[model samples]
Target chain A: MTGQDFPEPGPFATLSGAEVDLGRLRLRLVAEAERESLLDVVYRTVDAPVGRLLLAATRRGLVRVAYEVEGHDTVLATLAERISPRILKAGGRLDTVAGQLDDYFSRARSGFEVDLDLRLASRFRLTVLEHLREIPYGSTASYAAVAALAGSPRAVRAVGTACATNPLPIVVPCHRVVRSDGGIGRYVGGDDAKRALLRLEGAI
Target chain B: MGREPFEVVVERYGPMVLRVCWAVVGPTLAEDAWSETFLAALRAYPQLAPDSNVEAWLVTIARNKAIDQLRAQSRRPAPTERLPESIRWEEPDAGLDLWDALRRLPRKQRETVAYHYLAGLPYPEVARLLGGNPASARRAGADGIASLRNMLAPSAREKGPR
Candidate 1:
């Protein structure tokens, strides 16, 4: 019997399941974990004009944003593999970035004002992202122009690679880097999305 | 690469840990024990062996944290006997109240039951934690479980026919 005494020395006191508010208990655990710096990564997803965007951050700041096309689950698994496996889906560190993105998509904000963690980018790509951010809102820059601004005038192909592989996407303004002939370049968020972002900025 | 995210670990075992903690320390301090247990687990998760039995490991940590909480509690103003029986942690039960009956067991018997039955520690291991021998630990566990069944099970049998 489920509640019968353990003739073989089993425990009977836990016959009933505990009455626990798991959601509330998890909130408390997360709060304490965050306080102790045990929460290595906190991520959240936000609905943006491009699609549902997955946002991940460390205590360092905003790190990676993945498009709906990129597969959000894949992004999180890679984040867990590359970064600490201590990742959790919490929104405490991501609220500011999500709000900034909302403003950017609405054309109310011209620039992002959140700290960024660019650890996912290599040295040359870091240079490329730095130049991409200076491309300004409501404007477009040729990949060649971006390469030159990054102090690698002959590295136009590399600039395109950097833009395609940019981890921060919209926050880093990689969408503004277009083909020199004004053909919308290949984009991580796809051609239609790049065009939409340019249109949102009044650049098209 | 096979290491699970700490978030999964928490989700998989958080409830069970809370139950054991509630059993050991009661409702008032169970959350604190749970918080300490998981936070400690998080701090040391990276070094935890991938092939380890995470449930047993967590229970071991929970035992230590629960003991620490009890030790700290012992220094505080002792709670007098909970008379009038008005404050029931598990409420609305027409049958036997497990928390009420559990509170009547000796401290050693209570711990023996939790470690042996709930945490899945073997009797020898439970005895080691209790600073007693295996036979004594086994007896305490038997006593605790028997007391619970005697108190709670008859109600279940009688209610079944009605």
Candidate 2:
């Protein structure tokens, strides 16, 4: 056959494209199977009174808890870029955390016992998050109070910054940090979600 | 050395591995082989040498997975008169019929063609995968492509430059 018979660039390229799409679909199944062992991060969604929550974990522990308002896809993309990109939607590794969240949302659990992987948060933000956990199950603390607890009383706005970027919002109890003026401040899960958690805790 | 995220590996080599598997196993078991290959690769990715040719590595895994599938099929009892629906290629698209043409080639020719043409591997690498020297592998690939060209020419003329 003449060289021209091969067709410039040929049918192979077109076929490869279709094959790749099919491969991606098949990879989803494999990803489901290997998620626990191979994926750097595994995530699953749970329905709650606030909204859908996107729970993601690393091998270390729970890394992120995202509210629906944050856009789960966007949150996942960020996680992929910032953390490892080996992310998959599989819930097996999260069974314990899922049960804990179910209990917390149902008002049957007052505190989370799950180990947290807070590597996603920076040093100062992590300090604020650590302080957030001490805000008590049924009480609120001001940003200034959290700042003081985090050992930088002058960094109240930075405390707000930490809360805004808190990776594990509900699990870390960032909802318990309120404005000093007796106003419910902005929450990662939104002010309404904060109120829902506080009311569930009987702190409202 | 810092390792890249495994997702990059998947995205980069996923198509190549799928095509290689399809060429080796045909459509019926190609997806399964592809998935198994990737899952295995993902499990071993962290320990992989940083300078390794990732595409070649994945293609090798895909070849092994396809062989495993073929072995398992051979062990299964002969089918009754009625063929299983899963074995049928459902004709998802026109280009998909390429698999039927691929299945007609002898094993060495098919492997060489897939590794060289489909996966875009060099002759030496294809030879290594197929357990032969580069010259023989190149010849096999050329012969396979010639046969395919002859078989597919009429259809290509009819389709008119797609």
Candidate 3:
């Protein structure tokens, strides 16, 4: 700011001129927080065909994976309210998941092995999701079929709601659910993204 | 009412708190003070008034942590008698070499100057930490700066080349 104006003369500005390595400090902060168990959530974004995917995790495991259209800031705010507010962008915390996602998008991987925290979804929806993943890679299961497998044979609409609100999208394989009428149906990440994922998996 | 993600608070005020901690406690302990300050702040962040002065709150935490660190260091046996020439870093090229000059003042003077000048806190808040009226906090800061100038200014011409 002083550079934009004439440089002001004083001991004040020059007094605190020590070079602090913020990058180093941030890394150290992450390590210390982990050691103390003070870190509630760590998040980072990965570039993908789906645009930047905001990946959030707690110490337990991967929590939320959001598309750009979902509003990363808004998603983080919800996490702050529902979980703890002590979230930080630790560049390394999500490295494994990010790499796994890169593999998923590039088709080098067919399934996710990383741990997941699905506490955000309700119980029945969660049941629908568990059955959704068993559909296998590069395959489709009708929403009604998923609901039947989830023990709610008549709750096809509930199955659709579960897929629509799946918190951990590609990792949990909710994109594999389709309409029994031989249509693509809707997706949490929009049908276009769903099509891209389906096409990537060679399912379409 | 909503709260910002804690990362935003750290980015906004972390460096400033570190600088103030450096002035109050010296470089060796500043990072630890900063770490403790932010961790503590994060713990209590949700309860903080949304309109509160976040910087001032952080500086207050830093001050308390700095004092704790200083007390901890004082309890250790003095190392000076063991090593007459203690290892030191390279000195600044000009002025009073601010790091050393600030430490030479009394604690109240040093902290008053640091909070007001380095952290840009109002005199009332500095007084809150130092336990005096705003006028007294202002005087202490002025006296500290004047003392530093007296020690540093005359030496600039004479000591610059040397």
TM-score of each: 0.79, 0.65, 0.84
Error of 3 at A190 (Å): 3.2
Give me candidate 3's TM-score against the actual structure.
Answer: 0.84
RMSD of each: 5.4, 6.5, 5.0
How high is the CA lDDT of each candidate model? 0.79, 0.77, 0.79
- Candidate 2 local lDDT, B1-162, one digit each (tens): 344556556667766777677778776677678778878887776677778888888888888999998788679874432211222233465355576567778989988788877777788888898887988987898788887776567676477443
Q: Candidate 2 chain A, which ten residues in sequence have the lowest lDDT sum?
A: A1-10
Kindly report the docking quality category of candidate 2.
incorrect
Cα lDDT tens digits for candidate 3, A120-157:
99799888877877998999999888988999899999
**How do all the candidates rank in terms of DockQ, highest first?**
1, 3, 2
| Residue-wise C-alpha lDDT for candidate 2, range A119-200, written one tens digit per residue | 9898999889987888889999999999899999999999999999999988898889889999999988888888888899
The number of the candidate with the highest TM-score is 3
Clashing pairs in 1: none
In model 1, the Cα lDDT at residue A18 comes to 34
Off by over 4 Å in 1: A1-19, A181-183, B78-96, B106-144, B154-162
User: Each predicted model: what fraction of the native A–B Cα contacts (within 8 Å) does it retain?
Assistant: 0.30, 0.19, 0.30
